[model samples]
Target: MVDYATARMNMVESQLRTNKVTDQRVLEAFETIPRERFVPDHLRSLAYVDEDLRLKDDRYLVEPMVQARLMDVADIRAEDVVLVVGAGSGYACAILATIAATVVGLESDPELAKLAESALQEQGVDNAVVIQGEMNKGYPKQGPYDVILLNGAVAEVPKALTDQLSPKGGRLATVVRSDSGPGKGTVFERWEKAVGRRTLFDANTPVLPGFHKQPGFVF
Candidate 1:
């Protein structure tokens, strides 16, 4: 029998801590949440691995390291409301719920949303709610959010989502990548009428359902 509890601890120390995921609150969040519960039972044995776990609906649970890095970069505060796009299975939402005042997990797949909501309920995650809808559109009804984390990578973040950030200090973190090169974790902060961005780390998270880059003109 796999001791999932011990596996979770090892993941925190080796995959997370070794990767410079230093925020104690974030670390504790990862430590307490049982990642296995959020994944399909067949894949649960590999839950603690340092890679993305395949989920239904063509989405994936962003790898543990990438997820941790994004959480650390977002700097979610205790009183902040957050929004997670492509929240697959609710693992990211569950983790963010541990730190944020409220987390709205928006998933485009109804099946995945059900799984996420059920998992969160089983785990007693009260601060977060999973809703099924379009990933690119974002759940505007719950806006504006203090922090927005995309659980998957994107070729380019939609402007509509950027507009959903809570004014002033609201930030969004995601892995931006292209078919031509490696992905990099980037954080975007809304400032009045502008959004400032900076790279956080080199990473490659699975791309969200509708975030693919449109092709450019070719010869």
Candidate 2:
């Protein structure tokens, strides 16, 4: 059996810490969460590896580095109610639960959502609730969340999602693409009625489903 505990520690010390993820809470979450439980039985051995772990459908548990960096940039607070978009296997949601008061993990894949929910519950993560839904449409029923973290990249940040940010110090994070190419992880903060955004770092992450623009008519 793979030593997942050791692997998790190495991931935090090497992959995360070495890459600028300095937040103590974020580091501890990564260390504490058993990533092995979130992946399929066959993939469990590789769960702590640095790459993104593929799940059912075309979804992915965004790469470890990207996930860590996104959390580091969001700077989640103890009282924050967070919303996680495209929460693949609930790994990020579980991590967020450690730092935030509550987390709503949204996923379009029914099977994945069920699995994620079961895994979280099995691991005794009570602060997160994984639900099935379209990835682009933010979970409005739970909204006006303090922090919104997209598990994958996007061609553009949809207004529908940004509009769900809390009217206070709400913050959102996701990577944007340059015509389906590479992407840069960005953090957006709501300032009164307007939202201000800034790039945190570059991460070539997969774009979440439903966020892609419809194809234009070809000539």
Candidate 3:
């Protein structure tokens, strides 16, 4: 059996700390959350590896370095309510729960959503909830979120998702990957009626389903 506790520590010290993930809360969350429980039985031993772990239906738990960076940049506070888009297996949600006031995990895959909920509950993560929904459409019922995290790369940040950001310093973070190029870590911030965007770093993450660019009509 893999020494999962040691593996988690190694991931934080090597994968996260070495890569500029300096937020103490974020580091502790990665260390404490049982990543092994979020993956399939056969793949649990590989949970703390420095790569995105594949979940059911082509979904993925975003790699730890990228995830920690996103969380650090978002500056999640104890009173913030966060929305996690494409929250496969709920790893991110569980992590966010420790830092934020509440976390809403939106997953498009029904089975994955169920799995995430079960895993979260088993871990006693009471500050988070997993809900099934369309990934492109931000869950409007929980509008005006303090922080929104896209669990994977997208060709573009849809306005619908951005619209949910609280117009008072709310921020949304994600990796934006265009066709035939590398992905960029991006954050969108809202203030009153204005939204600003900035790129943080480069990543080569897998694009989530429903986020691909639409094909134009061929001549």
Top lDDT prediction, candidate number = 3
The positional error of residue 199 in candidate 1, measured at the CA in angstroms, is: 0.6
lDDT of 2 by residue, 119-213 (tens): 99998999899989888988999999999999998888888888999878799999887675569999999967899999878888877888776
lDDT: worst 10-residue window of model 2: 173-182
* C-alpha root-mean-square deviation, each candidate: 1.1, 1.3, 0.9
Lowest summed lDDT window (length 10), candidate 1: 53-62
Per residue, candidate 3 scores C-alpha lDDT tens digits across 1-219 of: 789899999999999999988889999999999999998998998898888888866788788999999999999999999999998998999999999999999999999999999999999999999989998998989878999999999999899998999999999999999888789999999998899999999999999999988899999
> By how many angstroms RMSD does model 2 differ from the true structure?
1.3
Candidate order by TM-score, highest to lowest? Answer: 3, 1, 2
lDDT of each: 0.91, 0.89, 0.93
* CA lDDT for candidate 1: 0.91
Candidate 1 residue spans exceeding 4 A from truth: 217-219
Over all chains combined, what TM-score does candidate 2 have? 0.96
The list of candidate 2 runs beyond 4 A from truth reads: 217-219
